[model samples]
Target: MRFIKFFFIVLGFSFLQSCSNPSLYQSKHYVFGTIVDISIYGEDEKKAEKVTKAVLEEFTRLHNSLHAWEKSDLTDLNESISKNKPYKNASSELIEIIKNARELERASNHLFNPAIGELINYWGFHQNEFNSMHPNQLKIKNLVARGPSLDQLHISGSTIKSTNPHVKIDLGGYAKGYALDQASKIIHEHHIKNALINIGGNIMAIGQHGNKPWRVGIQDPRGAQAIAKVDLLDGWAIGTSGDYQRYFINDGKRYCHLIHPFTGYPVQGVYSATVLIEPSQNAGTLSDVLSKPLFISKKEDRKDIAKKLRIYHYLIIEDKHISMTKAMADKIQFLNPNTQKNNQIEITL
Candidate 1:
């Protein structure tokens, strides 16, 4: 049944309903380079269908506007800005995304940088074509020394200009979460009380599964299965970043797409990071972007930065141990497969 898919591979939400009932309605679309799944409950079939349509339409709109690698609205904006065009036009939504990205870059202490698009392409992440070869040391050193950041971006009215000629914007990390938040808005606007949206395993939920809260599986970085599960109440979002998702191995070393802005290399030390935050327009985006900093930050600074960003619940898993905030430890149940690993530790913050 679909519940098995949710509980196992996709890290999706498993409803409390029976498989034979089939009362809940589900719709799936391929957009934003991930499977966008919407499940709606507590509404008639027709209304649920309509709500799903609205949500998918919103995703489509966002995919067209925000995609970095594709030939879309974002591509045009990036091209114009790179060419030093005079005060080019952009949608208000795009402007808001850039603005939020800049704020997040500062809030995360410049760890989560969207302005490293050149470095990203250099590593072949932009093409999904990691050849199991690292970039030349000179190139890496030059990029690192240059240190492009969103601070170089200046937005005014509907136009944006980059103060640093090397600055290039790629919103891949933040755009999916933003799109999911928009989908949630559409679901709520339709008054669909019980709904769950999972975009490439970045999940957000509203209402409940009948009388029970939605249960989500957090995937293990070591394998495809979920090592833990967390119950999510209404208006909560969770996003996870893991090296296992997009990486290539060279010799015995592993390289991933989540690059460290300062070093211009893939981040290490944490295999996976999961964050749970209160819902908002930026909640999903924050969840997605915050995980990188939490995973890559100094051990002592993780909690401080998390709290500074208003993220009360988060988990960081390394090779030998798992550490999490109390808010997360309280809500998560480790699956039996991970019960005796002896590395599950909790922190109070």
Candidate 2:
């Protein structure tokens, strides 16, 4: 469920003049098994470091709690649920994440499932080894036949239990967005004016960089070029999910890490999907989770699903075509004009 981190391009910023800009402080930290880069503008160096340090500490706390496979609080909770044992005193963070997961699971008709940990393991995605090796048909069939759903989990107050024995929850999909939201809160509490927090590829921009919108680039799924660029004003969050990030080619076929819960395999039909929305809407989780709807939801139902999920704008790239919401079409500038295929479809709903 790991998303490919998209690269952000700052249009008006220059790297050579960064040192002369004392109001800007930037640093990169290793958290959540990825490099998180944070930049703060309009703040003194000392104050920026203080704000960054506080956010980093928060990230450390969340990294230990929401990890999918690692031995952490979440793993402990998952182990308990797998054995039909309920954890009476789960953390509030875990409870909140699970509550959101359940809501999204129902909204997408189970297309977005956190209880597909077993299925993820079957495909060897639980480990870091994402190679040409795939699970056997029998294993896939068995898991698909008895796959678990987030609805099967029971959450009452602080207590949590799993009614299905095979249910194992993983929050890797929305974990980064959740982290960003928490970090944004900490940043705002510090009164930081302009800041950009990029966890892996998920980005949330607060305020503006020198009276200008924060510029971001969406990576081309088929190559290294940036296919689209966007300007993010205040309180904007954007993320991209691509099949190119974690994948393997076997017998001339490529397999990605994003598994479709219904089919128990990597989802096709989309090479990359980028979503933009207000972080305040859902604490930045919508940008992360909603980016994959083009691949997860049916074509006819995508607009309705996007509306239900509160996605403000989106751009989806396929093998030989592209599709975008009307909002995205107005905002996105295709860096490589040739990449905008002739069969482009506009979603207006």
- Best candidate per TM-score, number? 2
Query: In candidate 1, how many clashes are counted?
Result: 0
Worst lDDT run of 10 residues, candidate 1, spans: 1-10
lDDT of 1: 0.77
- Clash pairs for candidate 1: none
lDDT of 2 by residue, 56-147 (tens): 99999888888889888889988998788988899787898888888988877787788889988777677655456745888887898886
Against the true structure, candidate 2 reaches a TM-score of: 0.93
Candidate 1 residue-wise lDDT, 2-88, digit = tens: 001121233333453433346677777888776777877667789988888888888888888877777778778667667877446
lDDT of each: 0.77, 0.79
Best by lDDT: 2
Q: State how far residue 304 of model 1 sits from its true place (Å).
A: 2.4
